[model samples]
Target: MSGKIRACYACQRNGRLTCRRTRLGEPCLKTYPLECVDLLKRSRVAFQAGRTLKEGFRLAQLEAVVQMLEEHECGFVDALGRDLHKSTTLDECLMVSEPLGVVFIMGNWCSPVQTCLVPLVGAIAAGNCAIISPSEYTAHTAELLHRLIPFYLDNECFHVILAGANDLPEVVELRFDHVFFTGNRKEGSRIARAAACTLTPVTLILGGKNPCYVDQHCDIAITAQRIAWARFHNAGQSLAAPDYILCHTDIQAQLVQALKCYLIEFYGSDPRESRSYGRMVNLEIFNRTRDMLWRSGKVAVGGQVIEAEKYIAPTILTEVVESDPIMQQDVFGPVVPVLTVNNMDEAIVFINKQEKPLCVYAFSKNNEVISRLMSETSSGSFCSNDSVLQSLMVALPFGGVGASGMGSYHGRYSFDTFSHRKSCLLRGTRFECVTYLRYPPYEDRNLSLMSWACTLSQRSQGWCQIL
Candidate 1:
């Protein structure tokens, strides 16, 4: 029964299905614990039928996805709010034979909508059937996708399933051409292990403690404002949020004061009453974040927590050291710890001592400081004078390094991710005389000729390389 189908959790009890009619007046049955085996078989059949291979059909499907998003924009916005209490917000070469058949996409609570659909777009663009599983934590968004995707895309080629933690192992056992996952390290490891059993390719867009360095040479006020927004946006349930701050000891107090002033300016004197801020996803996340806030250094700014609302105020911590509990993991919350470094060198050393982060941020007007940070340190991505905005540009590839994650997808990178470029060499028998050098009758002259023909040089119009 195992096949290419993705599954996510809405908690076992929350798995409810409702019947609805499609735009064409066709009855769409939403079933719990979907007939995964049947669904995978049908999707495989559709792929083998070659319906998705045509450029016209692929383009049509892509357009339908856009139309669906445009028509259901309000529904998605409301669903996002319910899920996280927050707000808004490729190409190939050679033969480009076809897609990697069926792709299983499993997303997490962080940016549930984007994580699920962005990969799906790539899969569809590359002509692959997909099974999407939105994060179980964002049940409302999951349910919304479950209702909307089938209505717009080809039902036989696309399916959305809502499954719980208990179903994860069984669903992942299904053989798929590719598997894409986004979440924390623990679950990522589990997914990787399972995919390895079948030798299936996997793309992991995981999270880590992204670091931000506040240089004394830069405008503390501007730096403070930018960091505050990136760190606290969407109530800080962001994977790209600045997880911690490493600033020069000379301007530590000044930086802290500037951050406090801007926090007030942005969210008001009391953020709890502010409409701009958001809350944690659930009780478990709230407790973990709240505990980090208390166990870490003394709060320099906002540190209020309301369990009922799952709200953790936009907070900054002072007197923090590297050994603190909050520094150990990605503080996927509104709270950020500020650790002081004697100089840029100290900050660089401190940063290098830890696991490579998803992003390494530096705020400095001096180009040398920015250059030094860019060259000396390594992360999934690097940005100067800003935070998470580095990943926003479609032109750039976004992913992580080391424990952060591997593989990147954005714009054309996404298209390439789901595509299997089938190499085609349409050789003709007319060239048999020239190709005879590669035959079994090897000689020094033939070897020399082959090497000369294959070697690339700087004089060549293409990329220069040594053969």
Candidate 2:
């Protein structure tokens, strides 16, 4: 059998055995699958073999990881296309590398190329092992990862686990050095809890109802077009994508009209036929988003769904109330809600009331406005006059706060995550009178001298202190 197939079989067998063992308390022959055990053994051996952090990884190793990612990228795209009927942009695929001993739990809505692969690459470049648990909603992508990892990576050093909701507790209990998760607030909490039991450091990348604010002074055409692209990209299933729009009431109508034009231009008159648009991952998610659309608020643009195909058309809602389902939820599918506000202060206030988002985007040329927003709102990252692109920067720290998530990693940050920084101090052999004074002495003269010496030593390193 091909290596990929063998790896796939191994993962499948292990997953079944793990689930069965977890649920029934059965005595399985293996505590973990052979592949997992082998990988751990190899990693431990590598660590013990005097492989310095710098020497543990090689450029060739990174290249190999990239190559494997590329090999699976084709399969991943095909699988995701089959699952969602939408292919991710090329910029997304270039991201996956290897693990720096930090694993990322990717979200279903994330493009396999960027969200799943790139973080993997970041970890690998940092010379760490990674264990990816892809979103269950994106089963095909997850399966592809299970197959490709062992084929491309050293089976003894890199691994992927196919886990379900029930297997989460066991997976989290493994005492991984670091845990990186991308999902909703509820599940993020559960992952955090599991990591806490082991005191494992965690990096959570979660967001809720991110806002895109447009000032009246902003360029309407550029603002609307960027907003439309950000809001509708990957059918609006991005953490950093604009969740809602806040604009000054004076320019709200104009901006909304411009946005409508841009949406039609980007996705065409019939977005259902647009190959660029993607579908919801599964029927459950489709129904959940559909219910959110039907039960709450007003639909200003598209609210149509093709249930059999699990498709929700590019949608835009206006005047959505805070109590509306769309407002309350993360809206992981392609649906944009636009809310009009009086000014930047009101917009800031509105954002402050909700959970801190993974990303906050503001479109304004004014430095003061950008400065004020940056200073006032707390987010994992911020994009001024742009959206979703901030995460692409390798130098910046990427993570969330409060309910959104925690920890940050990108570029060297990934290296730091997997590394244990130990401090060592060497004592010198030089002896002096000060050292002798520290010996036992209870006599008045010695006590007085010791006290005076100590006082002098506190003032300066001098001969008086040596007395």
Candidate 3:
């Protein structure tokens, strides 16, 4: 292994050093240190090649890849759980099914199953190579992915680099044709800047403060049950899950009571003992959630904490103001803040005041309420009379708008993201007479004759009505 590592370094140095390193000597790897020029060249080649291939071919290839990954469901779920400490089989399929190009940037919060599988599926379908850089925080998942990816996919085409945060700039300098990043807004901004140097295309899926609305007419029992399920999923590590709730004043207490009952039913009185409930990703996230709980306005229900296990019970707070810290940031944890408003219109206004969220959930049976929310507010997607189920629909496009995210991908959208459309125009050989009249050289008499002929044709066809 040591000899192979040395040879790999030699390869990076353009073979300046000759070693007695054989194929058995640690499997010397070659690194392609791509630059802006390389990126432009590759993009041009990909665009031309892609134009020739039919979209149907791309879609079929991606579907086959997703099916293969799904077959190894246990391997994927285990890798994610080991890396992120809390992930499910469902999360693995949801994250990995949408693939991108060969190389992509992913966050620590995401499991290796998602970080590697998602872009792997996309890149292979697009017929592009990838350089994957997993998050530093999730070292175990990163290592597992670095080890397992070569076994599942072509090793030469897919490369995984585990590096420190400071090394990201050097890595980004490689000039990928497309940069697909999933992380916080601050880091996503840095990635955007780095990709901007080469004018490379980027798809950023960043953080969100998604709001859940509970209307007065909503069934309190069903609304609370759904909210509890969404808020506690993966300890609320999801970007599209409801971060806060906006309820009509008339139903606030009823909703709160129902929420309390559901929490007990789902996680029990002692949530730390519940196997279904998950913990925060790490100590830092636990501390952040703890601080938000302390500084919040009022605790409505489920404020229990288990610091050792990084567990914060499915918490709900009331009287949360716009200025509060919990309300201001993307509360990516098991805490749900409830704010009361007079009516549905006021709820829409409140949501519009903030940056667009990745998802929005409205618990209302009225068709008018659903229509208004869908048409008036801008979001990545929305779930009517429920929460988080929109993400389960593989057929629908999933992503955020404005500050939340830049592009979307899911199922067919994944194929579209990786493929470029080429326009073609076919001219007929039989239309020779009409084509001859369009030639440049012409005398005044000829021009007048052509104009008169066109006028007659137009009059005969009733062109005025057509115009």
Candidate 4:
């Protein structure tokens, strides 16, 4: 039946499903492909049956998910490593996150497993049926999730569709309670538009060119190290990572030299040989990032690219102009650009002129400088004296604004996103004497009494205050 994927798990073979999406005999699917609208309809039926309404049911499902994570813990780590070159230390960020209802979660490439499981797990915790659409870009990790999730989760309430982003046009048009997505602004806009047809609520954790500002009065060495770590993490393909830097004219040269030293100390002379650094997830991303080299900025360090291995060294550019195309686009790779700003005002002006970012990083010992950025600009999240570290705090909500995204999740926010609060009232059967006073009366006394009863019951100096 088309309801369930009949494709063999070994060969990923199924003419019925593969024929519609991809060609024959090419390992067409890395995971089992199922119709998304069908799953949404099924989940809605389950929701209507009040199956997911109980807190016990919600916790049990979450426990089962925890069990799955425990059982296949190594598989997830191994798969992510193969896909993103993520190390054990770097893997901690993905482990943190939590969700929404009969929901569809569209995962992105940079942090594939985290993007998929975080939202799905949260939905289950909130007692909502969910169907996960892990990104096809991270094939190995997505395939592994395809195999494990069904065995661990309830198939009737929880589902995973092994398909590409292209498959979602049909899914979005259908009436879904909610949709949680994490990706680029272009795709996020499309998802919002599609979801709008049904007036379905959506949580989009989209990306943009997040700005990191370095002031003259701060410690350049520590600033350089932290910025390098944040920017180069996962080979600098992070949604919240600093896209470009604004340095005070006085400290520009010092910061660059400090960044240059940290690059060699952290990733070695040739970063390609380093295990901690990651490569491009796909050719399309690599092509986009590789083209940034053509712009008219000085590559301060690490500009090498190996097309065959999909590796780009941790590179930094200086003297970058606002007119450059790289400044306009989200450089979702390990490319960092530094532009000189006269002072805090110029940096704030530059940041405000662009679309609101997912996060803003400001490094300064001066509390006033930090406060100015915090108060003057708009972003999904803000951190003073740090870079992209705000996302690591599970207590804080993470999402974007403007071209970045809308809706937020993490901690209690995740539960609130998926759980629709039903305002309830309980009335007693013994109140007939008081209740009957307001029912179908044609007397002035009855009307007066009814009005008095509806008013706020209060006493002034032990006497009734009803007017």
Each prediction's RMSD over C-alphas, in Å, is 24.6, 24.9, 24.7, 24.6
Q: lDDT of candidate 1 vs native?
A: 0.82
Candidate 4 lDDT over 181-259, as tens digits, reads 9999888888889999999999999999999999998999999999999999899989989999999999988998999
lDDT of 4 at 50: 75
- What is the C-alpha lDDT profile of model 3 across 199-253, one tens digit per residue? 7778887778998888888788998999988888888887778999999998888
After superposition, the stretches of candidate 2 with alpha carbons farther than 4 Å from their true spots are 1-109, 431-467
**Candidate 4 clashing pairs?**
none
The model with the greatest lDDT is 1
Which stretches in model 1 have alpha-carbon errors above 4 Å? 1-97, 441-467
lDDT of 2 by residue, 140-238 (tens): 888888898899997876777877855775788788867777777887788889989988877777767787889988889999888888888888777
Whole-structure CA lDDT of model 3: 0.74
Clashing pairs in 3: 99-122, 100-122, 100-123, 102-129, 102-130, 103-130, 103-131
TM-score each candidate.
0.76, 0.71, 0.71, 0.73
Model 1 clash pairs are 8-163, 9-136, 90-412
How should the candidates be ordered by lDDT, best one leading? Answer: 1, 4, 3, 2
| Count of clashes in candidate 3 | 7
lDDT (0-100) at residue 83 of candidate 2? 51
By TM-score, who's the top model here? 1
lDDT for each candidate structure: 0.82, 0.73, 0.74, 0.81
